[model samples]
Target: MTKALNEFLESNLKELKDNGLYNEINVVEGANGAEITIDGRKMINLSSNNYLGLATNETLKQAAKSAVDSHGVGAGAVRTINGTLDLHVELEETLAKFKGTEAAIAYQSGFNCNMAAISAVMNKHDAILSDELNHASIIDGCRLSKAKIIRVKHSDMDDLRQKAKEAVESGQYNKVMYITDGVFSMDGDVAKLPEIVEIAEEFGLITYVDDAHGSGVMGKGAGTVKHFGLQDKIDFQIGTLSKAIGVVGGYVAGSQQLIDWLKVASRPFLFSTSLAPGDTKAITEAVQMLMDSTELHDKLWENGDYLKEGLKSLGFDIGHSETPITPCIIGDEKTTQQFSKRLMEEGVYAKSIVFPTVPKGTGRVRNMPTAAHTKEMLDEALKVYEKVGKELGVLS
Candidate 1:
């Protein structure tokens, strides 16, 4: 490597470490369920996004194995070539039905779905009004489109309306689009989709919602779009199969014309290899399970409520979460990281969120209670939380 490149990387990494912004990844010894083993120790894991706990579901694992036996492991090529298998088509069809859309197209990952779909439809002449708290993938996707991005105040409808009116009246662009997350992951607040949709309609703006964190956890496992009964109104519904679905890949569900356009014009779909046969089969089975019963969904909410109440009873600032996601707020970044560390030492694994990821001085240890967590496991985790919080002077 060049001397300048090496020095640049080393200096940035040192800065990240000095500022407590560096991430240290942990390894799970076995399946990632309600509890995970790390470094020969077992802990109740509260840091995962496996909402319905389908990541380690036996049924989904069997489906994947069966697909591997019959179809092999890899996709072999990009979708436009020979990678579009019958399973991929079936997965897309099932996803469309689940999301209540006319058609759907799949990508290698949720990040890719955004990058591909956004750049495919939007152009330099377009302006995109995006939520300030939208995911990083959405920001990158907008950048790739070369569109004029206007950051609207997060979840503030009045601000969105004003910005949309200004951008539309300016006549500085051929088209305008509004994009946001169906559920804000950090704060666990559900977006005001109805209001956003109304605003978009008034301004003749295209609508896009990334429901990555809401699928399989809202609307009886349908999604936030279906949660608000605006399935037909939103122009684009993007979701991931990796989180609640417990598999891998991402997709966009919309009208047939939009899906066809993405299929042909999306660079990721045209150039990147399609999802593996095993992942496609597993994701299809997972979605079918979600459609078949609400058992997992209900259990997940039950656990979430139980955990939230436990944290609040202990006098921890759990934050205002509309969904199952819980955050134990700690005022300072160092103290927040220390709290998480002590919790892990006491047999609970909750990660800390600090600057850049969240606003300064609002550092929190985010918890995700899943359907697979038993009452006993949650109780134990609560006990650990109480112990750690008290030790850290976060509780009385």
Candidate 2:
């Protein structure tokens, strides 16, 4: 039986390798920043989600070190036990204020926050209206909730209204909720919050926004709800400390009642260990920096615009992107993979996104421009892009 199982696994693995679909991991030698060293060679990195360049910021590093000196290391227990430290309380309060919500609760990871928050509130009798293009975390969370899922077309307010209306009219569900990503990660498009809010209100549906990518990038760094001036209307505002905030963990900001219920009901909050002192402190400092100045955020957008314009000028098909996450759309998966390999050989570290992660034909090389990138670095990257494009026949 063991021999048969091993044979089955080997066959599947061989199939993947043969199709060029098997992924090979690359190890980064140091901290993730605008540029990274891989295999002892430094390259201009365009694959990180560290939008505001806070991941390796000096102030955040100092804050983390201080916390480690004071608090030692890990939280000894779960939040429901004795693990809720002063740092955790402080971070939650800070996040509540930042999101303009009444209360907030932190979890082990952004992914866990979704898993905890979604299942804590909605259940099998409930129905979830999710965006087709939402992040994998949101999808997993919704699935965990045991709720009947209804996928609305991506950012289509009319389709959302019709589906939501139909779900409500059925009278079979105990509750209904609409969830979406504030900013879609792959395409960099903003959700139509105003229209979504209006539809939710009309259908009496609870609203949830996972602002993982938008939290430290939009609304002068306040987030997507604040960007649309709809803070008071969104039921749950989910965000991550791992991305722009430069630390690990996630949180859900909402009404005092909702948070109180989650504190008692969420399994992850009750079962999982709390965030470490270092992460809590670093995230707090990052938030303070966002509130203090727009320097980093402005630089991020400046780099984004600069790179986007350069790619367009080179006759490459840069897709429609509202934020800094740009995708160089090369329709064929094999060609896109080849293009990415060539870019790596030329000392640029952009990754190719292929089928399953995206549609099969619309494979792309996604570029995440950060605030730490210099204009000189971008110019060099653009030169390599032009050279690779012509060599690969992607450009005339």
Candidate 3:
């Protein structure tokens, strides 16, 4: 009986190693900024999701330090068990105002926010109409909810309407929800929120958008829902503080009733420890900076455009990207991996995305252009790209 488990594990492990699909985690040795040190060597970083460069901002650092001095290091307990600090309340209020929602609730991480928020609302009686290319968190959340999941083609509004209409007509579900990523991290494409909203209204579907990548990159730094002016229509707006906000946590913004329900009902929020005081303070200051000035956002866009244009000029397939996340599409997985390794050896740190993360044969090297990256830094990265491309015979 025990032999089956050992044989299965050994076979699968050998298969993964033999297929060249096993991942080797790279150690990022310094701060996650535009440039970083890895294995005692400095490299221009294009793998981070810090779109606004807020992760390393001086103002945010100072705010976090100050909060630590005042509020100590940890919350010490779960939110329902005396972990909800004053700073947590303040951060929720700020998030509500920022997202233009009546209320908001924070969680330990964006992944947990999805896990908590999705299961809190939907159950076996409910059905979820999710985008096929939605994030892994959304998929896990849907699984956790035990809701019947109907996958619509990526960004296909007509397909979404069809599924929503069919699910509602059946009358088997207590509620129908439509969930999507406001900005898909892999493809860097914006979701069709306006069309989705119209369909959701027609079918009475609960609308949910995970704007993890869109926050601080779209709508002048608010998000894709705000970009499309659908704040009043979408029921749940899920976002992360770890990325553009430059801190650590996640939040769900919606009506006061929804937030109130999540406060007591969401398992992650009730069971997990609240965000630390320092993280809360840093995120709040980052949000304030985003609201007060568009300098970083504008610079991020400029840098994105410059990198995209440069890569395109060098005859690389940079896929259908509308945001700062650019993908240099190299079809074969081994080739793409080799290309990325070459880039790393040349002092540019961009990882490769192969099968499973993206469609098979659509392997790519994803690049993120942050505001902290100077033009010279980008230029140098491009030169490395050129050299690597030439060496690998990927470019003429």
Candidate 4:
């Protein structure tokens, strides 16, 4: 390695360590579920995004194993070069039906889906009006599109309308697109998509909603757009199979024309190898299960409510979460991290968010309660929370 490059990297890493911004990754042994084992200790897990508890579902695992036995483990090449197996086609078709869209296209990952879809339709001649609180992937995808990006206030419909009106009236670009997360992950707040759709219609702007978190948690697992009954009104419906479906992949559901264009133009789908057959089959089975019933979805919400109410009764500031995600807010960064550390030591595993991930001085420990978590598990976690909170002076 070059000496200059080594020095630059060392300096940056030193700064991160000095500032307490360095992340220490914990190794989880065994499958991720309602509980997990880390470093030879079992802990009540609250850091996962497995909303419906399907990640280790017996049905999904069986489907994956069956597919692996028949089709092997990998897709040999990119979709355009014959890697597009019948499994892929079936997965996309299932996704479209589940999403109530005309058609859909799948990608290797959620991040890849955002990068591929945004750049496929947007270019330098276009402008994208993005929510200030949109996910990092959406931000990166917009940047990669080479489009002029304008930030609208978070979930502020009036601001979006004004900016959209100006962009349209000014005629500074060929097209203007508005994009936002269907559910803001950090705060667990659902987007004001109805008002947004109304504004998009009046302004003739393209609409995009990244429903990664909302897909398995909202609208009986149909998602935020369907929750608002505006599926046909939105131009792009992006979702992930990893979070709630308990598998791995992402997709964009839209008009047939849009799916067709993405298939031909999206670089990741065109050049990168397709999703493995096992993953594809597993995702298909998961989506089918989601469509078949709302049992898992309801259980997830029940657990969320149980946790939220438990924390609230204990006088902890849980923030304004409208979903299963729970945030125990602690102002200072170091204190918040310390609280999280203490929780882990006491047999709970919740991660702290500070600074760049969330605003400085507004740090928090986020909890994700899933359908798989038993009442006994949540009660035990709560008892630990109470003990830790009192010791830290977070609760009286």
Candidate 5:
């Protein structure tokens, strides 16, 4: 490496370490479920996005095994280049039906799904109004689009309305779009989609919702759009098969025209390899399970509520989370990391969120309570939380 590049890397690494901003990832020993084994210690897991606990579900496992047996493991090419498998087509169709859209297209992952969809529709000639607290993928995707980006305050509908009015009346761009997450992952807040839809309609703007954390958790397991009955109002409904579906992939559900355009215009779909055959089939089975019953969804909400109540009762400042996502705010970055470490020592595996992932000084230990957790597990986790919170002086 060049000397200049070496120096830059060393300085940045030092800065991150000094500021307690560097992340240390823990490797899971086996299947990631309600309980995870990390560093040879079994602990109650509170940090996974497997909301429905379908990642290790026997049904999904068998589906993947069966697909691998028949389809031979890989898709062999990109979607437009004969990579499309029968399993891929079936997954997209199930996604569309579940989201109440006419058609859907899958991508390799959620990050690239945003990259593919945003850039495919918008360009330098257009503008996009995005929520300030939107995920990193959304920010990167907007940058890739080369469109004029207008940062809207987080869920401030009034601010959104004012910005929409200005961007529309200015007539500075040919087309505009408003984008948000169905559920804010960090704070666990739900987006004001109804108001957003009104603003988009008034301004003739496109609507895109990336429900990566909301699918299979909201709208009776359909998502935020269906929770409010706005399936037809939103133009692009994007989701991740990795989260609730507990597999790997992302998708965009919309009208047939939009789907057709993406199949042709989306760069990732045309360039990147398609999702693996086994994963596609497994994702289809998971989505089908979600549609067939709400047992897992209901249980997830119940556990979420139970955990939240326990955390709050213990005097931890769990943030205003509308979903199963719970954030225990710790004001300092190092302290937050320390708290998470202490939790691990006490038999819990909730991770810390520091600068960049969340605003500096608002560091937190975000907990994701899934349906796979039993009441006994939650109780034990809460006991650990009490011990750690008191030891850290985060509670009275």
Candidate 6:
């Protein structure tokens, strides 16, 4: 390595360590589920995005195995060059139905989905009104399109309306699109889709909703837009097969014309290898399961409410979350890290999220209680919280 590069790396790493910003990843010894093993210690896992606990479901596992036996391990080539397998077509069709759209297109991953979807329509001649707290993928997607991006305050419909009016009326751009995450992943608040759709209609702004976190959790498993019954009103319904769907991939569900355009124009679909056969089949099964019953969804919400109540009763500042995601807010960054570490030491694995994942001075240990968590597991976790909170001086 060059001398300058080595110095830069060393100095930056030291600074991060000193400031408690360096994230040390933990390895799960077994499958990620309601519980996980880290360094040979079994613990209640609360930091996963596996909202429905389908990651290790018997049905999904069987589906993946059967697919691997029938189709092999890889897609072998970029989609446009012959990698589009039978499972890909089926998954896209299912996604379209799931999201209540005319058609849908699948991508290799959620991040790539954003990269492909945004640039497929919006261009430098256009403008995108994005939520300030949208996921990083959305931010990069806006940047990649080379469109002028105006940041709307987090979940502030008034700000969105004002910006939408300004961008559309200015006539400086050929088109304007407003994009937001259906569920704000960190705070767990939902996007104001009803008012947004009203504003969009009044100003003729294109509407885009990336419901990655909301896909399998909201709308009886459809998504946040579906939760609000705005399927017909929103132009773009983007989602991930990874999070609540419990597999790995992303998709865009929209009109037939939009799907047709994405097939040809989205760079990831055109240039990247498609999803593997096993993962695709597994994801398809997961979606079907969600569509089949609301047992899991209902249970997930039950557990979420249970955990939030427990944390709140113990005098921990669990933020207001509409969904099952719970965050115990610890004001200082280092203390937040310490709180998470202490939880792990006591046999629970809830990770600390700090700047720039969230704003500084608002550090937190976010918890995700899935349907698979039994009352016993959650009770134990709450006990640990009580112990940690008092010891750390977070609760009196």
Find the candidate with the highest lDDT and give its number: 5
Model 2 alpha-carbon drift over 4 Å, by segment:
none
Over the stretch 287-380, how does candidate 4's per-residue lDDT look in tens digits? Answer: 9999999999999999999999999999999989999999999888878878999999999999988878887788899999999999999999
TM-score, model 6 to reference: 0.99
Give the better candidate number (3 or 6) by TM-score: 6
Over 123-150, each residue of candidate 3 has an lDDT whose tens digit, in order, gives 9999999999999999999999999999
- Each model's lDDT comes to 0.93, 0.92, 0.92, 0.93, 0.95, 0.94
Task: Put down candidate 5 lDDT per residue, 1-396, tens digits, no spaces.
Answer: 999999999999999999999999899999999999998999999999999999999999999999999998889998887999888889899999999999999999999899999999999999999999998999999999999999999999999999988998998999989999999999999999988998888889899999999999999999999999999999999999899989998999999999999999999999988999889999999999999999999999999999999999988898889999999998899999999999999999999999999999999999999999999999999999998888889987
Clashes of each: 0, 0, 0, 0, 0, 0
Per-candidate TM equals 0.98, 0.98, 0.97, 0.98, 0.99, 0.99
Lowest-sum lDDT 10-residue window in model 6: 238-247
Per-candidate RMSD, Å:
1.0, 1.1, 1.5, 1.0, 0.7, 0.7
lDDT of 6: 0.94
Where does candidate 4 have its weakest 10-residue lDDT segment? 15-24
Residue 5 shift from truth in candidate 3, angstroms: 6.0
Per-residue lDDT of model 1, residues 294-378, tens digit only: 9999999999999999999989998889899999999788888889889889989999998888988999999999999999999
Q: Report the alpha-carbon TM-score of model 5 versus the true structure.
A: 0.99
- lDDT at 29, model 1: 97
Model 5 misplaced stretches (Cα beyond 4 Å): none
The TM-score of candidate 3 is: 0.97
Tens-digit lDDT track for model 2 on 205-269? 99999999999899989899999999999999999988888788999999999999999999999
